[model samples]
Target: MKPIFKLQNRKLIVIFGLFIIAELGIEIGFTFVSARTGFYFVLQFSILMATLFILFLIERSMNRTKQELTKNKQKLQNIFDTLDVAIWSHELSSDTLLITQGIEKLYGYSLEQFYEDKSLWKKVVVPEDMHIIEEREKKLSIGEPITSTYRIVRPDEEHRWILDRGIPIFDAKGNFVDFTSVLFDITHRKESEERYRSLVESLPDMIAVISRGKIDYINPAGFKLVGSSSAAQLIGQPVKAYLPAHVLEQIENEREEKKTFEFMLNRLDGKRIDVEMSAMPILYGGRSAHQVVVRDITQRKKAERTIQFMAYHDSLTELPNRYRFKQHLSRILNSEGDRTVAVMFLDLDRFKIINDTKGHTVGDQLLQKVSQRLQNTVGDEGMVSRQGGDEFIICMEDISKEKAAEVAQRLLDVFTSPIAIDNQEYFVTPSIGIGIYPEDGTDEETLIKHADTAMYLAKERGKNNFQFYSPELLDVSSRKMELEGGLRKALDNQEMILHYQPQVELETGKLVGVEALIRWLHPQNGLIPPAQFIPLAEETGLIVPLGKWVLRQACEQNKAWQDAGFPAIPISVNISVRQMDDEHFLGSVTEALEKTGLAPRYLDLEITESIMQNIERSTDILSRLKELGVRLSMDDFGTGYSSLSYLKHLPIDSIKIDKSFIDDINHPSNQGLMVKSIVDMGRNLNLALIAEGIEKEEQVSFLKRNSCAIGQGYYFSAPVTAEVMRKFLAEGFVSV
Candidate 1:
């Protein structure tokens, strides 16, 4: 290879070096060739072949170079087509430009359209960024390069963020040629940065960056939260100086340990703030910076305290609740002191009547008013708590039984005056029971039980009174319990029977009606009168069923008397308060009338004065019963506290004078005057008058002179069974 390349170069160089020599050589070579073989033409032919071979090699090299150039140009075109960036130039004089195809894809405009007017590129730039773009371009025109990010709007009205770098191309003579620029779509990158900035600024917590122990940056919220004019005022101020001593200690601890901390920070406005701050060390430009977030929790802490208080106190009266009271009771019971403690229980009598007749709104008002009155009456010696509806418990510490009684008496006195609720006057009485410490019982449970027993005893004796727990009271209650058990059995055994006492017309001396009274003819014990057990029956609700039995039996016996051709006198049966208010009272009466086939007029119902006053829903019930054509009489009148106004409104046909007035009829001065006045009042009110307990002739004379319509007592005839009463009625309404 070297030998061939050397021969060619040497021949060419020798020829060029000796052009004259080459010419003489050519002449000599021709003369020699002509002489040797007469071949001058052959020599010329050889020279021509050599020149043609060299031209052929030159043409081959040119073709290969052109093929390589074409390949490289294709590669450059592919690079421009695939690139996301657009490369372009602008000729400022003509305002015509060259833009890559990427410009068409990026701005939704054809490259030809963009190049048609160079100003189109400027117009595509968002108007908000137009001033900045122009200012930057001006900088670039003065031999400076420009690199900026600005928004450009596409044909679809979507805005894109682009990074543009441009430089002015100049000639060697320093004249401006064109603008050479590269544009890159940077919309995603710009959005990420904007999101980060917005999230930091929108936080509710106060966030700050402290570099080198001084404030460097803080969000806008931190300024208002830290009681500062601006971040500038806080900058350069030592972080330790802005915090309290405790907060400073916390911050230093957190910094040393590289941990988060929480504390209270007091602002310049005298407000104490509960803040939890998390601080981290961030490197900024090769220096350490602390980014802290402070959150205020003052309101949350206050709410926690409020919830805690509500759990321990009563919501209505704001007093120690039952839960707390039990805790106190247990503590007192466990103490080793000899101090006396009395637990008194007081229940308001007939409280439910007021609540039922009126409304619960009035009931609530009454409770509030009563609570105030009880608080004022107790003063400060004892604790009065509302045990429940219409019931209260008083705890008097270091008090004897007598002292406890006095306290209970004081409470009872508070209820003496009528209580007004919702413009309605109501009088309520209390039955109180007291149990003393170490005597009644040692523990709270036993003491409460004994107090309850004592309270019931007080109610039995009479309401508006207080009783101390005594052994005798317990014995009497036990006996009464035994009697109740016996009576319940007696009913099943058919030992309970009804007795009738004839009611005679004083003027006619003829039987008008008979009062059917209950008599428990015990198998062993002879007879139990109505006076002895009727009250107990009513209290225990035994009167409802027992009263029904009495009504049916009385109606049947009276009908039998009429069928037997005896006088058709009406029969009266007493109805207790409970029976009158029973839902089945009217049904029971109708059933009895149907069974006995007794007319309603011949079946009279006698209700006591007290029962009439307190019967629940009496207005409609009484009126309905009156519509049934049954006789209604008020028994034991002038004994109960009845309002004359209400009495006149009742659907009663007659008033039976109580036995108390009849018992004292011999003392004419007072008793006679009372009976005369009652009879006159009843007559004037158009109510029939019946004087009961007329045992003496003098009493009969007094009642007859007072114009009493009827009289019945042991003097006329005692309560006898239907068999004995039949014989007596057959004997003209007299005793056999």
Candidate 2:
């Protein structure tokens, strides 16, 4: 469409042309007709009519143009109304602002308000975003295009995000004329962005965006994860600064796919931490980049290490366990070359006695001390491991039997000095046995077996010593195994028998009681002594049932003699610590007495001084026995290191001086004095004294002189069969 000014100028030119044409026509007619006959007048009238007609046509065309312009302006207004955008124009010449009706939809203001007050649009802009409008105005004054985004608050107190874009118009003289701008409502888009930012900021794991190998954006979690105080500290930093070169290369190589990796992350604080990272390709800032999420796994890694350590090491001593020791031995044996590998099997001597008496807490402490000593004694020479209980196995490669022996001696020597546990000095000793590779059998099992056998031999040969594996040791081990097997079946086969030893009054020469002793008569091996099989029973845990059998048998036999019209006498039955520790021990004793129809007063339960180790428990057990109307005597009284206070508290009717003291009672030295002191102490405590293992008359006389009344030994009669004991019972007295 043409401008109004141009249209008006065209009309004026047409009218002027028509006037010139009419004047020319009149002049030509006057010339041709000599100014007569009204010819000029007629010509002027026709030209004037033609000019008027042309003016009419021009006026009609201008009307049609105006109509079209109006229609087009209406269509543009409709288009602006359909979109969520407001269009406005400012004319610098007139100082006027023209805005579309859509301005009401965008700013909650009508066109009239904007026209009445151009500053109203500026006032609606949020205070923080007013700077954007000011900057855009400055750019527009310089004839520069304006494109800005800012927030605005409408008259209804509602906030909105606006995207304002404009193009500056200029005049022919290069002076700024006006600017037409379009404003779009972007509140929804801004809300979405805020939600996403909120989600990222609140996450516990780190989120980062990388562009061009540098950190483009990082969440709050990322800042904390990398030990950065602010975004400025981490932004624009190369991803390579945090990630290792290999990790970056891996991420770059697989940029198109999502992947996770676990590695040590170097923190900004110079501490390395375990981290799990997941990376995926993303469009950051409209360019291909990577988005990574990181999690710290330092605690998880530490827990894993702890679990792994627990799997291979003993919890109590922190030493390699039996499983680990076997693994070490197998590894050495598998790769053994022309070198001698010595496996030393060590068993703490009498460790069970200490463990049972002193309680497991002390036992555990002792074992820990032994483990530390073993490690120190064999430092760098071998690997020391606990084989459960008080047993330790050591492996030394490229060592000779002599070297092993020397190491074993060092181990024994280390324990020679007392170990201090809970303010108490304990004299613990180790009996170590050495087994050589290729000589003491080939494989781990055979070598360990040989070593164990030699250890038993060391124990048997008066403990606190070390011995090397020999063929002779295997024979002894085989005999022991045979004895253990035979002992298990002895009770069921009725191969066990009891012998009664007379307990006589040393001064009166009268038999008062008899001690029941267990004898195993192997069907094939003849009679086997208690020393040969009793320890085997205890080691195998068969003593609990065996002691019950002994108690019942002694009770039944004594009852039989009483029913047979013989003299009534109490029978002594030995009780093992294993039986004492049994939970049903009291029940067993009750059952034996009830089933045998034996009076409780005719029975005596013999306990050794070792019971004093657990004084409280011992007192309770002995007090209960005393309540059952049975006599309790402490056998081997002086051997167990029982304190005088312990003896005072225990409820015992008698104290049997152990044979070790009795054998030296006649000697003219401190030996007799020791026995005399024990007798005197027993007398003062109101405890009956009985001397065991008295074989000579002089020993008997010395015991009688010391006021020890009761005695049992060869001096009376050896442990006799029940049939022979009946004759002794009938005889009633033996000549002392």
* Candidate achieving the largest lDDT: 2
**Per-residue error at 667 for model 1, in Å?**
24
Cα lDDT for residue 703, candidate 1 = 82
Q: Of the candidates shown, which would achieve the greatest TM-score relative to the real structure?
A: 2
Error of 2 at 702 (Å): 20
TM-score for each model: 0.53, 0.64
Tens-place lDDT digits, model 2, residues 440-508: 988999999999988888888988998899998767778888888888899999999999999988777
Q: Rate the local accuracy (lDDT) of all candidates.
A: 0.77, 0.86
Clashing pairs in 1: none
| CA-only RMSD, every prediction | 12.2, 9.1
Candidate 1 on 242-316: residue-level lDDT in tens? 556665555544544454556677665767677677777676557767778877767776777767766655555
Stretches of model 2 off by over 4 angstroms after superposition: 1-192, 305-320, 350-369, 420-425, 480-489, 498-519, 526-736
- lDDT for predicted candidate 1 compared with the true structure: 0.77
Scanning candidate 1 in windows of ten residues, the lowest lDDT window is 1-10
